[model samples]
Target: MISSANILFEFICFVMALCFLKGNDKFTLFTKLYLGLVCITETSGFLWMMCTNKSNIWIFNIYILFEALYISFGLYHFIKPFKKNVKPLYIATYLIFIAVYLYGSFTRGFFKFQTTAIMVASVLIVFLCLYYYHNLMKSDKIISIRNNLGFWWVAAVLFFYFGSTVYNLFMNVIFSNKPFAYEILVYIMLTLNAILYGIWSYSFICSSRHQKLLTSSY
Candidate 1:
């Protein structure tokens, strides 16, 4: 039930991104593509599970690689307007994450989740989101917070990733507790996904409204 709701949330967010964010700019286009990939990857995971009756970890393993890259780039896109010299920071983080992820994949095999790599990526993302907030607060652009698409989008990412930090860090311990802990984690994931996609949908709407205002002013 909860899993289905998360899937529904994913689809809804993807549709919203398509309708509101498509073709606006390079970042928006990349966002649209990323959301599309999310939908496809999710659907493929379910189908793979149904057919093989086995773990589809490999699908998500590959997905996370792109997820990290796209999200890092998205943060960089938003942050570059304020800080010109941040490219190396973003690039270096990606390099570290890719190396960690590859090591996890090779050592544990693709069938296992790369928990360490995920933790690293999630922690880094949370920090980047904080950095974004820090810059936004210090900038003269404070008045645009209400309809700032990038702000809202990054907020959603922060909430989702930060909220999942506990689960990501304690996956083995949680699973070791058997059905109860597992069920708890499932609910946690459902809530996290809701927060993520819910805010993403709203951010798309905000972007649409902002664009309309700009168009009308001309």
Candidate 2:
């Protein structure tokens, strides 16, 4: 169960939090909080499993609530400069996600994985990422995405949730019965986690660089 990809994800999240703590990104506070939560949840979930030898599904079910809120709020923050009117949509969607999660918890029970809620959350995040891109392009900005921390952040969300989604859709039918399939799926998820955190870590670095540039200019 312990693997390099898991190690990599944890390492990246830890480092990203460090970068955000010292950096002066406009959203540095939010960045640090989110990354710190990411690390904490991951560590706590692992330790709880090892200590009790119990299923971690319940923990993740709760984690998804915070996950959805944090991501939706973050997107709302990012998109504020472009469209103020659209901000309410994010708030409404976040409330919907919470409602959906509540429904899932009641219907599926805490012990089971709520794939429907997860899929809904994932779909919303992926859609937000696409919406951000569409707005980014519409803005006529000439800057490369590399310098845009928001772009990288959105991209990370896009890739991880989108990749996991395909698995979410057919995993029970295709991979549940096979012996090694679950293990392979776990690794695939780890890789996706790595991608999300790795890009996020770099985005923090980019934010730090820009923060320094602004300070030096002043």
TM-scores for the candidates: 0.95, 0.89
| Sequence-dependent TM-score of model 2 | 0.89
Off by over 4 Å in 1: none
Q: What lDDT does candidate 2 reach at residue 57?
A: 77
Candidate 1 per-residue lDDT over residues 121-190, each given as its tens digit: 9999999999988998898864476667898999999999999988897786776665567888878888
lDDT score for residue 86 of model 1 = 91
Question: Model 2 over residues 8-64: C-alpha lDDT tens digits?
Answer: 576777676575536455466666676677667777888888899998778778778
Give candidate 2's error at residue 145 in angstroms: 2.6
| Cα-lDDT of candidate 1 | 0.87
Highest lDDT scorer: 1
Global lDDT of each candidate: 0.87, 0.77
